[model samples]
Target: METRIRSEARSYLFVPGNRPERFAKALLAGADAVIVDLEDAVAPHDKDRAREAVLRALPELASVYVRINAADTCWFDEDVGAFAAHPAVQGLVVPKAANTEALAHIDSRSHARLALLPLIESAAAFTALDAICHAPRVERLLFGTVDFQLDTGFGGDGEELSYFRSQMTLASRLANIGSPVDGVTMALDDAGEIFDAARRAQRFGFGGKLCIHPKQIAPTHDAFTPTEADLAWATRVLRAAQGSAGSATVVDGKLIDVPVIERARMILARAR
Candidate 1:
Protein backbone atom coordinates (compact mmCIF):
# COMPACT_ATOMS: atom_id res chain seq x y z
CA MET A 1 0.00 0.00 0.00
CA GLU A 2 3.05 2.26 0.17
CA THR A 3 2.52 3.39 -3.41
CA ARG A 4 5.21 6.03 -3.26
CA ILE A 5 7.77 3.23 -3.63
CA ARG A 6 6.66 3.00 -7.25
CA SER A 7 6.74 6.75 -7.89
CA GLU A 8 9.87 6.35 -10.01
CA ALA A 9 8.30 3.95 -12.51
CA ARG A 10 8.99 5.20 -16.05
CA SER A 11 6.59 3.26 -18.27
CA TYR A 12 3.01 2.03 -17.83
CA LEU A 13 1.87 -0.18 -20.71
CA PHE A 14 -1.86 -0.63 -21.28
CA VAL A 15 -3.46 -3.94 -22.21
CA PRO A 16 -7.16 -4.44 -22.97
CA GLY A 17 -8.98 -6.20 -20.15
CA ASN A 18 -11.43 -7.84 -22.52
CA ARG A 19 -8.58 -9.47 -24.39
CA PRO A 20 -7.25 -11.79 -21.73
CA GLU A 21 -5.14 -13.59 -24.31
CA ARG A 22 -2.87 -10.55 -24.49
CA PHE A 23 -2.38 -10.21 -20.74
CA ALA A 24 0.62 -12.53 -20.48
CA LYS A 25 2.35 -10.84 -23.39
CA ALA A 26 1.86 -7.44 -21.83
CA LEU A 27 3.07 -8.59 -18.42
CA LEU A 28 6.29 -9.91 -19.96
CA ALA A 29 6.80 -6.88 -22.18
CA GLY A 30 9.24 -5.30 -19.67
CA ALA A 31 7.15 -2.29 -18.69
CA ASP A 32 7.58 -0.72 -15.27
CA ALA A 33 3.88 -1.53 -14.87
CA VAL A 34 1.16 -3.25 -16.88
CA ILE A 35 -2.27 -1.67 -16.74
CA VAL A 36 -5.17 -4.00 -17.67
CA ASP A 37 -7.52 -1.46 -19.19
CA LEU A 38 -11.26 -1.81 -18.64
CA GLU A 39 -12.04 1.77 -19.63
CA ASP A 40 -11.80 3.23 -23.14
CA ALA A 41 -10.31 -0.01 -24.45
CA VAL A 42 -13.44 -2.07 -23.76
CA ALA A 43 -16.59 -1.79 -25.82
CA PRO A 44 -19.94 -1.29 -24.03
CA HIS A 45 -21.18 -4.75 -24.92
CA ASP A 46 -18.00 -6.29 -23.49
CA LYS A 47 -17.81 -4.40 -20.19
CA ASP A 48 -19.42 -7.10 -18.07
CA ARG A 49 -17.47 -9.82 -19.81
CA ALA A 50 -14.31 -7.82 -19.40
CA ARG A 51 -14.93 -7.55 -15.69
CA GLU A 52 -15.41 -11.30 -15.45
CA ALA A 53 -12.42 -11.92 -17.67
CA VAL A 54 -10.22 -9.85 -15.35
CA LEU A 55 -11.53 -11.71 -12.33
CA ARG A 56 -10.39 -15.00 -13.82
CA ALA A 57 -7.10 -13.67 -15.11
CA LEU A 58 -5.98 -11.99 -11.91
CA PRO A 59 -5.52 -15.28 -10.09
CA GLU A 60 -3.11 -16.63 -12.69
CA LEU A 61 -1.22 -13.42 -13.33
CA ALA A 62 1.13 -11.39 -11.17
CA SER A 63 -0.13 -8.09 -9.71
CA VAL A 64 -0.91 -5.46 -12.34
CA TYR A 65 -2.74 -2.15 -12.36
CA VAL A 66 -6.29 -1.88 -13.76
CA ARG A 67 -7.70 1.16 -15.53
CA ILE A 68 -11.37 1.17 -14.63
CA ASN A 69 -14.22 3.18 -16.08
CA ALA A 70 -14.86 6.67 -14.76
CA ALA A 71 -17.04 7.15 -11.68
CA ASP A 72 -19.86 8.71 -13.71
CA THR A 73 -20.37 5.51 -15.71
CA CYS A 74 -22.63 2.67 -14.51
CA TRP A 75 -19.72 0.26 -14.73
CA PHE A 76 -17.67 2.23 -12.23
CA ASP A 77 -19.15 0.81 -9.03
CA GLU A 78 -19.02 -2.72 -10.32
CA ASP A 79 -15.39 -2.31 -11.33
CA VAL A 80 -14.44 -1.10 -7.87
CA GLY A 81 -16.46 -3.75 -6.09
CA ALA A 82 -14.80 -6.53 -8.05
CA PHE A 83 -11.16 -5.41 -7.81
CA ALA A 84 -10.96 -3.34 -4.61
CA ALA A 85 -9.67 -6.23 -2.55
CA HIS A 86 -8.32 -8.43 -5.30
CA PRO A 87 -4.89 -9.73 -4.29
CA ALA A 88 -3.47 -9.56 -7.80
CA VAL A 89 -4.36 -5.94 -8.34
CA GLN A 90 -1.53 -3.49 -7.61
CA GLY A 91 -3.81 -0.45 -7.90
CA LEU A 92 -6.60 1.18 -9.91
CA VAL A 93 -5.97 3.68 -12.66
CA VAL A 94 -9.02 5.88 -12.30
CA PRO A 95 -9.90 7.62 -15.56
CA LYS A 96 -11.42 11.07 -15.95
CA ALA A 97 -10.71 11.77 -12.30
CA ALA A 98 -12.05 15.14 -11.08
CA ASN A 99 -14.17 14.86 -7.96
CA THR A 100 -12.45 14.38 -4.60
CA GLU A 101 -15.72 13.22 -3.01
CA ALA A 102 -15.96 10.33 -5.47
CA LEU A 103 -12.30 9.51 -4.80
CA ALA A 104 -12.99 9.29 -1.07
CA HIS A 105 -15.86 6.91 -1.83
CA ILE A 106 -13.56 4.71 -3.93
CA ASP A 107 -11.01 4.65 -1.11
CA SER A 108 -13.71 3.55 1.31
CA ARG A 109 -14.83 0.85 -1.11
CA SER A 110 -11.27 -0.43 -1.39
CA HIS A 111 -10.78 -0.17 2.37
CA ALA A 112 -7.72 1.90 1.48
CA ARG A 113 -5.92 -1.14 0.11
CA LEU A 114 -5.52 0.10 -3.42
CA ALA A 115 -3.63 3.11 -4.71
CA LEU A 116 -5.50 5.65 -6.82
CA LEU A 117 -3.95 7.08 -10.01
CA PRO A 118 -6.15 10.00 -10.94
CA LEU A 119 -6.12 10.84 -14.63
CA ILE A 120 -6.14 14.62 -15.07
CA GLU A 121 -7.97 14.82 -18.41
CA SER A 122 -10.29 17.78 -18.37
CA ALA A 123 -10.52 21.49 -17.52
CA ALA A 124 -12.52 20.56 -14.42
CA ALA A 125 -9.69 18.27 -13.32
CA PHE A 126 -7.12 21.07 -13.71
CA THR A 127 -9.27 23.39 -11.60
CA ALA A 128 -9.39 20.76 -8.82
CA LEU A 129 -5.85 19.37 -9.14
CA ASP A 130 -4.72 20.12 -5.59
CA ALA A 131 -7.87 18.68 -4.03
CA ILE A 132 -7.65 15.54 -6.14
CA CYS A 133 -3.93 15.12 -5.36
CA HIS A 134 -4.65 15.47 -1.65
CA ALA A 135 -7.58 13.02 -1.87
CA PRO A 136 -7.22 9.86 0.17
CA ARG A 137 -4.89 7.16 -1.18
CA VAL A 138 -4.06 9.05 -4.38
CA GLU A 139 -0.61 7.74 -5.27
CA ARG A 140 -0.07 9.66 -8.48
CA LEU A 141 -1.64 11.85 -11.19
CA LEU A 142 -1.74 10.89 -14.88
CA PHE A 143 -2.06 13.30 -17.79
CA GLY A 144 -4.68 12.11 -20.26
CA THR A 145 -3.33 14.29 -23.03
CA VAL A 146 -5.55 13.06 -25.87
CA ASP A 147 -8.87 13.28 -24.09
CA PHE A 148 -7.72 16.57 -22.56
CA GLN A 149 -7.14 18.01 -25.98
CA LEU A 150 -10.64 16.93 -27.06
CA ASP A 151 -12.20 18.31 -23.89
CA THR A 152 -10.33 21.63 -24.03
CA GLY A 153 -10.51 22.04 -27.85
CA PHE A 154 -6.76 22.20 -28.38
CA GLY A 155 -5.76 21.70 -32.00
CA GLY A 156 -2.30 20.32 -31.21
CA ASP A 157 -0.27 18.77 -28.40
CA GLY A 158 2.94 20.75 -28.78
CA GLU A 159 3.64 24.07 -27.06
CA GLU A 160 -0.15 24.60 -26.88
CA LEU A 161 -0.40 22.27 -23.88
CA SER A 162 2.80 23.38 -22.13
CA TYR A 163 1.08 25.63 -19.61
CA PHE A 164 -1.37 22.95 -18.49
CA ARG A 165 1.41 20.35 -18.29
CA SER A 166 3.43 22.64 -16.04
CA GLN A 167 0.34 23.25 -13.92
CA MET A 168 -0.07 19.50 -13.36
CA THR A 169 3.60 19.23 -12.35
CA LEU A 170 3.26 22.16 -9.93
CA ALA A 171 0.07 20.74 -8.43
CA SER A 172 1.69 17.33 -7.92
CA ARG A 173 4.73 18.91 -6.25
CA LEU A 174 2.48 20.97 -3.94
CA ALA A 175 0.43 17.91 -3.00
CA ASN A 176 3.57 15.78 -2.51
CA ILE A 177 2.29 13.22 -4.97
CA GLY A 178 4.57 11.46 -7.45
CA SER A 179 5.44 13.54 -10.52
CA PRO A 180 2.45 13.24 -12.88
CA VAL A 181 2.59 10.76 -15.78
CA ASP A 182 2.47 11.96 -19.37
CA GLY A 183 0.00 10.50 -21.87
CA VAL A 184 0.71 8.08 -24.74
CA THR A 185 2.50 8.71 -28.00
CA MET A 186 0.27 7.69 -30.91
CA ALA A 187 3.13 6.47 -33.07
CA LEU A 188 3.56 2.74 -32.68
CA ASP A 189 6.23 2.18 -35.30
CA ASP A 190 8.50 5.12 -34.65
CA ALA A 191 10.68 4.69 -31.59
CA GLY A 192 12.40 8.02 -32.26
CA GLU A 193 9.12 9.92 -32.07
CA ILE A 194 8.22 8.11 -28.85
CA PHE A 195 11.64 8.90 -27.35
CA ASP A 196 11.31 12.56 -28.35
CA ALA A 197 7.86 12.82 -26.80
CA ALA A 198 9.01 11.12 -23.60
CA ARG A 199 11.97 13.51 -23.37
CA ARG A 200 9.60 16.43 -23.88
CA ALA A 201 7.46 15.15 -21.01
CA GLN A 202 10.56 14.79 -18.81
CA ARG A 203 11.47 18.40 -19.60
CA PHE A 204 8.01 19.40 -18.38
CA GLY A 205 8.63 17.52 -15.07
CA PHE A 206 6.63 14.33 -15.70
CA GLY A 207 7.92 11.15 -14.08
CA GLY A 208 6.52 8.69 -16.61
CA LYS A 209 4.69 8.17 -19.88
CA LEU A 210 1.73 5.91 -20.73
CA CYS A 211 2.55 3.32 -23.37
CA ILE A 212 -0.24 2.03 -25.62
CA HIS A 213 2.12 -0.32 -27.45
CA PRO A 214 4.85 -2.58 -26.09
CA LYS A 215 7.22 -1.23 -28.70
CA GLN A 216 7.21 2.13 -26.91
CA ILE A 217 8.78 0.73 -23.73
CA ALA A 218 12.52 0.79 -24.51
CA PRO A 219 12.54 4.30 -25.89
CA THR A 220 10.49 5.58 -22.97
CA HIS A 221 12.96 4.06 -20.51
CA ASP A 222 15.84 5.49 -22.48
CA ALA A 223 14.29 8.93 -22.32
CA PHE A 224 13.81 8.84 -18.55
CA THR A 225 17.28 7.45 -17.77
CA PRO A 226 20.14 9.85 -17.08
CA THR A 227 22.76 9.72 -19.83
CA GLU A 228 26.41 8.94 -19.11
CA ALA A 229 27.32 12.58 -19.63
CA ASP A 230 24.61 13.64 -17.23
CA LEU A 231 25.85 11.17 -14.62
CA ALA A 232 29.41 12.40 -15.08
CA TRP A 233 28.32 16.02 -14.68
CA ALA A 234 26.34 15.15 -11.57
CA THR A 235 29.31 13.33 -10.11
CA ARG A 236 31.51 16.33 -10.80
CA VAL A 237 28.97 18.62 -9.14
CA LEU A 238 28.79 16.44 -6.05
CA ARG A 239 32.57 16.16 -5.79
CA ALA A 240 32.97 19.91 -6.21
CA ALA A 241 30.35 20.69 -3.54
CA GLN A 242 31.85 18.27 -0.98
CA GLY A 243 33.69 19.95 1.95
CA SER A 244 32.46 23.37 0.77
CA ALA A 245 31.11 23.90 4.32
CA GLY A 246 27.82 25.32 3.00
CA SER A 247 29.66 27.74 0.76
CA ALA A 248 28.99 28.05 -2.98
CA THR A 249 31.51 26.36 -5.30
CA VAL A 250 32.20 26.22 -9.01
CA VAL A 251 31.57 23.18 -11.24
CA ASP A 252 32.22 23.31 -14.97
CA GLY A 253 32.49 27.10 -14.82
CA LYS A 254 28.97 27.40 -13.27
CA LEU A 255 28.40 28.34 -9.62
CA ILE A 256 27.30 25.21 -7.72
CA ASP A 257 24.72 26.62 -5.33
CA VAL A 258 22.47 24.61 -3.01
CA PRO A 259 19.84 24.22 -5.73
CA VAL A 260 22.44 23.06 -8.25
CA ILE A 261 23.80 20.52 -5.78
CA GLU A 262 20.27 19.32 -5.05
CA ARG A 263 19.63 18.94 -8.78
CA ALA A 264 22.84 16.93 -9.14
CA ARG A 265 21.75 14.61 -6.35
CA MET A 266 18.41 14.08 -8.04
CA ILE A 267 20.09 13.28 -11.32
CA LEU A 268 22.40 10.80 -9.61
CA ALA A 269 19.49 9.25 -7.79
CA ARG A 270 17.65 8.81 -11.06
CA ALA A 271 20.72 7.20 -12.54
CA ARG A 272 20.78 4.75 -9.70
Candidate 2:
Protein backbone atom coordinates (compact mmCIF):
# COMPACT_ATOMS: atom_id res chain seq x y z
CA MET A 1 0.00 0.00 0.00
CA GLU A 2 2.93 2.30 0.68
CA THR A 3 3.89 1.78 -2.95
CA ARG A 4 0.82 3.86 -3.78
CA ILE A 5 2.44 6.85 -2.10
CA ARG A 6 5.95 6.14 -3.41
CA SER A 7 4.91 5.82 -7.03
CA GLU A 8 2.83 8.99 -7.29
CA ALA A 9 4.82 11.27 -5.00
CA ARG A 10 7.54 13.31 -6.70
CA SER A 11 7.72 16.10 -4.13
CA TYR A 12 7.53 16.10 -0.31
CA LEU A 13 7.09 19.53 1.23
CA PHE A 14 8.16 19.90 4.84
CA VAL A 15 6.53 22.13 7.44
CA PRO A 16 7.89 22.70 10.92
CA GLY A 17 5.79 20.92 13.53
CA ASN A 18 5.45 23.87 15.88
CA ARG A 19 3.87 25.98 13.18
CA PRO A 20 0.40 24.46 13.01
CA GLU A 21 -0.90 27.30 10.89
CA ARG A 22 1.48 26.53 7.99
CA PHE A 23 0.64 22.84 8.15
CA ALA A 24 -2.80 23.43 6.63
CA LYS A 25 -1.34 25.73 3.98
CA ALA A 26 1.32 23.12 3.17
CA LEU A 27 -1.27 20.39 2.73
CA LEU A 28 -3.10 22.65 0.32
CA ALA A 29 0.15 23.48 -1.52
CA GLY A 30 -0.08 20.73 -4.21
CA ALA A 31 2.95 18.84 -2.97
CA ASP A 32 2.71 15.08 -3.35
CA ALA A 33 3.11 14.76 0.42
CA VAL A 34 3.49 16.96 3.46
CA ILE A 35 6.13 15.95 6.02
CA VAL A 36 5.54 17.37 9.50
CA ASP A 37 9.05 17.70 10.81
CA LEU A 38 10.04 17.11 14.43
CA GLU A 39 13.75 16.78 13.69
CA ASP A 40 16.37 19.27 12.56
CA ALA A 41 13.82 21.91 11.66
CA VAL A 42 12.52 22.18 15.20
CA ALA A 43 14.45 23.67 18.10
CA PRO A 44 15.70 21.42 20.90
CA HIS A 45 13.65 23.28 23.52
CA ASP A 46 10.57 23.07 21.34
CA LYS A 47 10.51 19.29 20.86
CA ASP A 48 7.76 18.66 23.39
CA ARG A 49 5.48 21.35 22.04
CA ALA A 50 6.14 20.30 18.45
CA ARG A 51 5.34 16.68 19.19
CA GLU A 52 2.10 17.67 20.89
CA ALA A 53 1.20 20.00 18.09
CA VAL A 54 1.88 17.29 15.49
CA LEU A 55 -0.13 14.67 17.38
CA ARG A 56 -3.02 17.07 17.83
CA ALA A 57 -2.89 17.95 14.18
CA LEU A 58 -2.57 14.34 12.91
CA PRO A 59 -6.23 13.32 12.90
CA GLU A 60 -7.02 16.46 10.92
CA LEU A 61 -4.22 15.61 8.49
CA ALA A 62 -5.42 13.25 5.80
CA SER A 63 -2.06 11.57 5.09
CA VAL A 64 1.16 12.97 6.51
CA TYR A 65 4.67 11.69 7.24
CA VAL A 66 6.12 12.75 10.58
CA ARG A 67 9.90 13.05 10.74
CA ILE A 68 11.06 11.99 14.19
CA ASN A 69 14.25 12.92 15.96
CA ALA A 70 17.36 10.71 15.74
CA ALA A 71 17.23 7.31 17.46
CA ASP A 72 19.92 8.35 19.93
CA THR A 73 18.37 11.62 20.94
CA CYS A 74 16.65 12.08 24.31
CA TRP A 75 13.40 12.67 22.45
CA PHE A 76 13.66 9.54 20.28
CA ASP A 77 11.98 6.95 22.53
CA GLU A 78 9.21 9.31 23.53
CA ASP A 79 8.59 10.17 19.89
CA VAL A 80 8.02 6.54 18.93
CA GLY A 81 5.49 5.86 21.68
CA ALA A 82 3.66 9.07 20.93
CA PHE A 83 3.04 8.77 17.19
CA ALA A 84 4.48 5.57 15.71
CA ALA A 85 1.26 3.82 16.68
CA HIS A 86 -1.04 6.71 15.96
CA PRO A 87 -3.67 6.02 13.33
CA ALA A 88 -3.46 9.52 11.94
CA VAL A 89 0.26 9.38 11.18
CA GLN A 90 0.62 7.55 7.90
CA GLY A 91 4.41 7.35 8.06
CA LEU A 92 7.45 8.10 10.18
CA VAL A 93 10.73 9.46 8.88
CA VAL A 94 13.54 8.18 11.09
CA PRO A 95 16.58 10.45 10.96
CA LYS A 96 20.24 9.52 11.50
CA ALA A 97 19.62 5.82 11.04
CA ALA A 98 23.22 4.53 10.96
CA ASN A 99 22.83 0.81 11.65
CA THR A 100 20.49 -2.16 11.83
CA GLU A 101 20.40 -1.76 15.59
CA ALA A 102 18.99 1.73 15.30
CA LEU A 103 16.33 0.57 12.86
CA ALA A 104 15.61 -2.49 14.94
CA HIS A 105 15.19 -0.37 18.02
CA ILE A 106 12.75 1.86 16.23
CA ASP A 107 10.99 -1.09 14.64
CA SER A 108 10.54 -2.57 18.07
CA ARG A 109 8.39 0.43 18.89
CA SER A 110 6.78 1.20 15.52
CA HIS A 111 3.71 -0.43 14.00
CA ALA A 112 3.91 -2.47 10.79
CA ARG A 113 1.39 -0.32 8.94
CA LEU A 114 3.47 2.77 9.48
CA ALA A 115 5.78 3.36 6.54
CA LEU A 116 9.33 4.07 7.67
CA LEU A 117 11.68 6.41 5.82
CA PRO A 118 15.28 6.32 7.01
CA LEU A 119 17.59 9.22 6.31
CA ILE A 120 21.10 8.17 5.34
CA GLU A 121 23.48 10.69 6.91
CA SER A 122 26.40 9.48 9.01
CA ALA A 123 29.53 7.70 7.70
CA ALA A 124 28.49 4.71 9.78
CA ALA A 125 25.24 4.53 7.77
CA PHE A 126 27.28 4.05 4.58
CA THR A 127 28.87 0.98 6.15
CA ALA A 128 25.47 -0.41 7.16
CA LEU A 129 23.51 0.61 4.09
CA ASP A 130 22.52 -2.94 3.22
CA ALA A 131 20.98 -3.67 6.59
CA ILE A 132 19.29 -0.32 6.88
CA CYS A 133 17.65 -0.60 3.46
CA HIS A 134 15.99 -3.95 4.24
CA ALA A 135 14.87 -3.25 7.77
CA PRO A 136 11.25 -3.90 8.75
CA ARG A 137 8.47 -1.61 7.52
CA VAL A 138 10.97 0.43 5.53
CA GLU A 139 9.20 2.25 2.69
CA ARG A 140 12.33 3.88 1.25
CA LEU A 141 15.61 5.59 1.99
CA LEU A 142 16.24 9.36 1.77
CA PHE A 143 19.66 10.86 1.12
CA GLY A 144 20.57 13.55 3.63
CA THR A 145 23.32 15.04 1.48
CA VAL A 146 23.77 18.16 3.58
CA ASP A 147 24.29 16.21 6.77
CA PHE A 148 26.37 13.65 4.85
CA GLN A 149 28.80 16.31 3.65
CA LEU A 150 29.24 17.49 7.21
CA ASP A 151 29.86 13.93 8.37
CA THR A 152 32.22 12.84 5.57
CA GLY A 153 34.10 16.16 5.21
CA PHE A 154 33.06 16.45 1.55
CA GLY A 155 33.20 20.04 0.28
CA GLY A 156 31.25 20.47 -2.93
CA ASP A 157 27.64 20.84 -3.90
CA GLY A 158 25.48 18.23 -5.65
CA GLU A 159 28.46 17.33 -7.91
CA GLU A 160 30.50 16.10 -4.93
CA LEU A 161 27.58 13.92 -3.88
CA SER A 162 26.98 12.23 -7.23
CA TYR A 163 28.71 8.97 -6.30
CA PHE A 164 26.86 8.82 -3.00
CA ARG A 165 23.52 9.63 -4.63
CA SER A 166 24.19 6.95 -7.25
CA GLN A 167 24.84 4.44 -4.47
CA MET A 168 21.52 5.32 -2.81
CA THR A 169 19.65 4.81 -6.10
CA LEU A 170 21.47 1.49 -6.63
CA ALA A 171 20.89 0.30 -3.10
CA SER A 172 17.17 1.04 -3.25
CA ARG A 173 16.80 -0.79 -6.55
CA LEU A 174 18.79 -3.77 -5.27
CA ALA A 175 16.50 -3.96 -2.26
CA ASN A 176 13.43 -3.70 -4.51
CA ILE A 177 12.56 -0.42 -2.82
CA GLY A 178 11.38 2.65 -4.65
CA SER A 179 14.07 5.10 -5.77
CA PRO A 180 15.26 7.25 -2.85
CA VAL A 181 14.34 10.92 -2.47
CA ASP A 182 17.16 13.48 -2.69
CA GLY A 183 17.78 16.17 -0.08
CA VAL A 184 16.49 19.76 -0.19
CA THR A 185 17.80 22.74 -2.12
CA MET A 186 18.47 25.62 0.31
CA ALA A 187 18.11 28.24 -2.39
CA LEU A 188 14.77 30.06 -2.37
CA ASP A 189 12.48 31.24 -5.22
CA ASP A 190 14.88 30.10 -7.96
CA ALA A 191 12.73 27.59 -9.79
CA GLY A 192 15.33 27.08 -12.51
CA GLU A 193 18.06 26.12 -10.04
CA ILE A 194 15.69 23.87 -8.10
CA PHE A 195 14.48 22.21 -11.28
CA ASP A 196 18.06 21.64 -12.43
CA ALA A 197 19.09 20.16 -9.08
CA ALA A 198 16.02 17.92 -9.05
CA ARG A 199 16.52 16.90 -12.70
CA ARG A 200 20.14 15.98 -11.98
CA ALA A 201 19.03 13.74 -9.15
CA GLN A 202 16.30 12.21 -11.32
CA ARG A 203 18.87 11.44 -14.02
CA PHE A 204 20.96 9.74 -11.35
CA GLY A 205 17.86 7.55 -10.56
CA PHE A 206 16.23 9.40 -7.67
CA GLY A 207 12.44 9.30 -7.71
CA GLY A 208 11.65 12.33 -5.54
CA LYS A 209 13.10 15.36 -3.78
CA LEU A 210 12.60 17.00 -0.38
CA CYS A 211 11.24 20.55 -0.34
CA ILE A 212 11.76 23.04 2.48
CA HIS A 213 8.98 25.24 1.12
CA PRO A 214 5.86 24.90 -1.00
CA LYS A 215 7.34 27.06 -3.76
CA GLN A 216 9.83 24.28 -4.59
CA ILE A 217 7.15 21.62 -5.07
CA ALA A 218 6.02 22.39 -8.62
CA PRO A 219 9.53 22.60 -10.13
CA THR A 220 10.61 19.43 -8.36
CA HIS A 221 7.61 17.59 -9.75
CA ASP A 222 8.38 18.98 -13.20
CA ALA A 223 11.93 17.63 -13.00
CA PHE A 224 10.94 14.07 -12.10
CA THR A 225 8.29 13.75 -14.80
CA PRO A 226 9.15 12.53 -18.28
CA THR A 227 9.13 15.05 -21.10
CA GLU A 228 7.06 14.63 -24.30
CA ALA A 229 10.20 13.48 -26.13
CA ASP A 230 10.78 10.81 -23.48
CA LEU A 231 7.21 9.59 -23.75
CA ALA A 232 7.51 9.47 -27.53
CA TRP A 233 10.77 7.50 -27.39
CA ALA A 234 9.36 5.05 -24.85
CA THR A 235 6.27 4.56 -26.97
CA ARG A 236 8.41 3.81 -30.02
CA VAL A 237 10.72 1.47 -28.11
CA LEU A 238 7.87 -0.56 -26.68
CA ARG A 239 6.15 -0.79 -30.08
CA ALA A 240 9.39 -1.96 -31.68
CA ALA A 241 9.93 -4.63 -29.00
CA GLN A 242 6.33 -5.86 -29.32
CA GLY A 243 6.65 -6.15 -33.09
CA SER A 244 9.91 -8.09 -32.75
CA ALA A 245 8.24 -10.72 -30.54
CA GLY A 246 10.43 -9.69 -27.54
CA SER A 247 13.58 -10.34 -29.59
CA ALA A 248 16.45 -7.84 -29.97
CA THR A 249 15.55 -4.78 -32.04
CA VAL A 250 17.48 -1.73 -33.15
CA VAL A 251 15.82 1.63 -32.53
CA ASP A 252 17.51 4.91 -33.31
CA GLY A 253 20.87 3.14 -33.62
CA LYS A 254 20.56 1.45 -30.22
CA LEU A 255 19.92 -2.22 -29.49
CA ILE A 256 16.78 -2.86 -27.45
CA ASP A 257 17.07 -5.91 -25.22
CA VAL A 258 14.88 -7.29 -22.42
CA PRO A 259 16.33 -4.88 -19.88
CA VAL A 260 16.06 -1.96 -22.27
CA ILE A 261 12.45 -2.89 -23.08
CA GLU A 262 11.61 -3.15 -19.40
CA ARG A 263 13.05 0.31 -18.79
CA ALA A 264 10.99 1.65 -21.66
CA ARG A 265 7.86 0.10 -20.18
CA MET A 266 8.67 1.66 -16.82
CA ILE A 267 9.13 5.09 -18.36
CA LEU A 268 5.83 4.78 -20.17
CA ALA A 269 4.14 3.53 -17.02
CA ARG A 270 5.43 6.54 -15.10
CA ALA A 271 4.28 8.81 -17.87
CA ARG A 272 0.78 7.48 -17.44
The models' CA-based lDDT, in order, is: 0.89, 0.86
Clashing pairs in 2: none
Error of 1 at 41 (Å): 0.9
- Measured against the true structure, the TM-scores of the candidates, in listed sequence, are 0.95, 0.93
**lDDT for each residue of candidate 1 in 1-272, tens digit (9 for 90 to 100):** 32342367899999999999999999899999999999999999999999999999998766688999999899999999998777678788999987796688778877435788989899999889889988877888999999999999998888999999899889888777789899999999999999999999999999999999999999999999999999999999988888687788888888889889999999999988
Question: Which stretches of candidate 2 lie above 4 Å from their native place?
Answer: 1-8
Tens digit of lDDT per residue, candidate 2, span 109-147? 766577888999878988888787788777788888889
Evaluate residue 198 in candidate 1 and report its C-alpha lDDT on the 0 to 100 scale.
96
TM-score of model number 1: 0.95
